[model samples]
Target: MRGYQEDTPPSSISGDEIAGMDDEEAVFLGYLDEMDELVDDNMEEVTDQEEEDTDMEPPEDLSILVFNKHVGSVFCCDLHPSGKLAVTGGEDDKAFVWSVQTGQIVFECTGHKDSVIFVGFSFDGAYLATADMSGLIKVWKCNLDENQQEPWPIAFEYEAEDLTFGLWHFGARVLICGAVSGDIYVFKIPSGDIKVLQGHNTRVECAKMFKDGVRLVAGYDDGAVKVWDLKTNAVLQQIQANVHDMRVTAIDTHPENNIMASISSDGKVILATSSNGKVVGQLQAENDLETVAFAQDPQLGFFALGTLNGDVGIWDTARQMVRHQCTKSDDESVVGVTKMIWEKDHLITGCLDGAIRVYQGRSGEKVLQLTGHRSEVLDLCFNENENVILTTSDDGTARIYKYEINKDKD
Candidate 1:
């Protein structure tokens, strides 16, 4: 057996030494120094605050209901159609269906061997689907008969290549999932009938269904966007790969128009016709885009884009210009947005800084900021009426917030 020997520690490189290095090496050293300083500053701030408020309690106004059953980071969450219940999945490989009003677990979805990355309710609240990172998917029948004594029975289950995202059809029991194997799987619930939509050997990063319910638009990691005819499992149209230089972060379609908008981490936004995938308009951003959402009303003629640098822009689709630059709250740190939705004339966003913020879509003003989680918000969703907002976070809790527009701000 060979004897183990400890390697000598490297001497610290000085600023002068870094300056004399090549451009790439000097830049790398500078990034390291900046990161070190940032860590030191955050540590100092946290230590000081801990010492100052050792016995303080958090305010009760943070959330209306908090679901703390998850043992690890909650990765995904969805609100029930009735707005009375919610389903959340977490890193602990479990999913919980809980009451929103009282924060009581209604169903505990178990038997997963990996982190549950996605959980959603079917359109009519008839079924709940939970998908894990290892491609295990389970669908449980909801709203069971009151006389039944057993737990909710599993309606459907399947295994596929590692899953990236999953979504339920708006009007049907169909469920669609994207996989790392560059395939989109559509499963009709209970029956487990499968339809495979083949992709161009690249991971499907995100997808959205057209309002017509027959067409689906999918964005790929290699910067391709394809519109698929779900009925035939054929590609109806596709945008060229050169349109975006990097992975598509998010995508949304206009409610009334035949237009689809997709944003990339490379700071590019492409607006294309969903019918033909023709490139109609494009916008460039200064920072990497994280999320995108279109106004529900076609008359608004605008969409919102959230960036990784903590900036939000409301773009006028017709005029191809920024209409309003929404600002964050003054007290918030520069934690980027992770998800967003447009409800009526307002935009609700979930941030990495563990805050749910509401902005006025018409005037681009920050209206509300709700906080509770101590870590990043991973996912969020709202009810049909937009009155109940549910968010899951890395803090191992899911929070429910009641939302109401402040007419006084108008």
Candidate 2:
């Protein structure tokens, strides 16, 4: 070791003691210290992957919530941002609410004249919105507090037809919605005001604000991926030319929004950005895709891709490759994937076959299969209460599933 001076012996390396005994040893030791720091920062990650390696099994203890039926197929669902309740939309042309904890039906919202395609919560869990094929979006004032018996009345509404999808900006009170007419509308929550954004040459399949509200991304049937500035509401970039060989079904941003990915009906998954507006990498699952989710933890940078053909591919986004994939039995093609949510080591899956399965994110395996819905389970949400899961299905119902996490699983 090189000696440091207590007072005045601090001359820089010059003579034999400074240079003599161990030049190579000093350089090697410095390199070792640098490596040690890197290891310390990354040790938890290495441990997580190792845990994935040993146990890919879903947890065993899964129980059903309440199941209240709708008249027709339930098309979509959104959990109250509080996770204490759920709102579901369906072919029945109605919306219903359920208690997440007790598995009980609470309210059935009636207003939309046609089938409801999508529903979502405001950032604070105070408001909710649902969209239908008629191009109308209804905003409702909701109270998730279990103390209330009757549901709250409709607070406000926005009208749109040929509607595709709508999502609130990350944790903001504003919403960005898109329609088949190639118009993207941004709605100010609870106020019922709207802005129509125009650019795409065809129907917009999905619209969501990314990078907090700094940027907005929309995918259209023309295979075009467009980015917009949230403030000026201007098009920032556009990348087109057949993203999949078919329709672009869904798109979502990485947690940071610096990168985003889109899925095409022809089985294409693209990783791209707004700056250069090019796909960094791409993957084709077995069949057309439904939804894609990025992991919450940044360093893990994992993603789960759900396909219409019953195939789910888990990706290490940093490595840009499928780390593991699983197909349910041999007969089930993944018709849908709700979202990839992490609970400790598990990534819970909600499938179109009305089955909710959990898998170890590190290795793709069926950990638990929650069977209850008589039809396709279209939407699911996790978090809030970490041990519980919420799902809505085509059987015109919403159900919650609960479980206990054991130390062995962790």
Candidate 3:
């Protein structure tokens, strides 16, 4: 019988030296050698993977034009009806009308006592309105002549009580504004005439003009929704406060029908008729709701909703159910959605993570992500032709991205 070495360890004995040991000891030493080789191979692979990951770069900035003049957070932005210019208001208490083609400042709207909360162009692109949080509203007549170098004249001005939001009529020279005091003011631009619609002592959170251009829908902080007659200054219909149970965040009217959709901060979505204010449908989400938008085409019979939890749900109006849910990647943190709009078959969303995501409206899959802003997106609007998007952010900047249809998705 062969004697075995008692003091030496298997790892210290090499395969060449194992021949002098007992058969059992030699086999154990051989196994140890093989295990050492396997560990070395794994370490090499891991080191190479780490190096590759370290070399990866962040996504490129996709904005075609960046507006960096605002000294503070940009609160609102709009594209001109002719798609030749853009207007943005910010916490800097200033508003700028800049050319889209050259990004040159066409006019600087100043003299606001507080932050400019809203800015937009009129339906015909002849008037531009800028409003501040302290209720200072100024309307400017846009001079489109390329040879004209003078500043646009102030056509109208008014001071209300703590204004919250403003809207422009789609077909007329009417500018509607909502106030914290629950009063909705309608102003006929250039004339400075005003009509006041009283609310039930709750702040008017959001409002929209109907396609007919005669009626308006306003949502309140107490969860009440009212359809008001612009001509009569009377409530045409009302949805009582018990339905939403929270502050209304947004409201949108259908393009070709009497249906209106309103979302509340408590995650309740109410679909009602703009004519009678009758509750036609309702959807409840598990997270707080932030924004909602109806498809541009009425034939699609669906609308998209955004949540504070980074969820996008495309709901079928006829079925009263979610057709598809768009979610973020697993590696991504929760990114709240602040605003959204539908253009043709696409859903464009502005997120708190500072990304503008474009989703395929038919499949609910994200097709493109545009990045540039360093803070939350406050608002967004697209050109009349839907080939460009203008977005404002809390980062004190606004950016424009060219919208190209991804034909591969079709």
Candidate 4:
């Protein structure tokens, strides 16, 4: 077996000081002991605007502030493709579906035996999937009757030990995941049929669906990326090209082309063709890279890469040069970037410091900075069609924000 083990820090806890502890101890001490101060710090500081409105009311700065739901830190969040609903999963072992406008809990998912590590929405928004650290996945019908009761009935269930990441096909018919045992599992919707594709020797860090959903691009903790064919459950290509020196952190597929972009913990980005696993371009960075994203609009012709030292770079894909870069100011402390997304002419990023910052896509200038979480920001999603953003953090909260256009400025 490849020697690499899956050691990325859990979203429920943060800090390199406690990185050596087992999962159980880390979750307990990090959330219980470390967060005792956080609960007080987060609860006591109310803005003057909030005080004027009411002690318990949400301040005017946010569209919705969800509270009193998760007892532990939130680990992940996703928006429905329809953009009207959102789901969040966390250390509380519960997942919640809520309205974007009202913040009312539409349904509560309560069957997990451990922390819900990831929550995802189907591409068509017809189904919602939640997976826990215990390697259990539960799927729920998203279009259930509005009056449906809590503890939503599961439409499908699958068990695989140490499931790390999951995503749906473009048609929302098949669910795929990577496991710590280096196995890939694909379960078809409504049907219980299961297929296993085995190739990677170490823990799988990330996976992406490409080639009209007939192929999967998987990255492993051993710094290997392989493409698998869904039809025959066979390995289509093994990349013999430039490989990451460290664990592969993230992967993003091109919206129009057959290229896939990936980043490693060693601060390098590689653009490779999906068909043959041939390296097309590589961008080297001065800091360790953590996450990456490709611009959906073909005309943009650029990709975004985020680093451990609070740096964001927009590299021109054609020219293979850094077109723009954004870094923390002198007054701001450096924090690792955890996730990134590209929207209309803007870049949205989540950081280890529990802050979300928006920068201009072309100029790399700071457009907006938001802070509310008491710990690291774990995951985030943006729906351009609805102009809404959802962020989940270790502070045990998921927030919804809308991008407002200033009509007066135009």
Each model's number of backbone clashes? 0, 10, 0, 1
Better of 2 and 4 by lDDT: 4
- What overall lDDT goes with each candidate model? 0.86, 0.73, 0.87, 0.78
| Top TM-score model | 1
lDDT of 3 by residue, 22-141 (tens): 889877767977987987888788888999877856347788888989998999999998888999999999999997877888889988989999999999999999999999999999
lDDT of 1: 0.86
Q: For residues 1-410, what per-residue lDDT tens digits would candidate 2 score against the true structure?
A: 22335687543644565456577867875696798787776786777888986676533424566556677677777776666777778888887777766656777777788898888888788788878888878877886666788667787776766777777776678877777788888888777677778855689888656756678888888788888887787888776566556777888777777788888877788888757688788887756578887776666678888866667777889789878875543344445665455665567777766778777676676666777776677777764555567777667667777654332232
Clashing pairs in 1: none
Greater-TM-score candidate between 1 and 2: 1
- Against the hidden reference, what TM-scores do the models get? 0.85, 0.76, 0.83, 0.79
Error of 1 at 257 (Å): 4.4
TM-score sort, best first: 1, 3, 4, 2
Which candidate should be chosen as best, given lDDT against the real structure? 3
RMSD of each: 8.4, 23.6, 11.5, 13.4
Error of 3 at 150 (Å): 1.1
Candidate 4 differs from the real structure by a C-alpha RMSD in angstroms, to one decimal, of 13.4
Query: Which tens-of-lDDT digit does each residue in 366-401 have in candidate 1?
Result: 788888877778998888654778999998999988
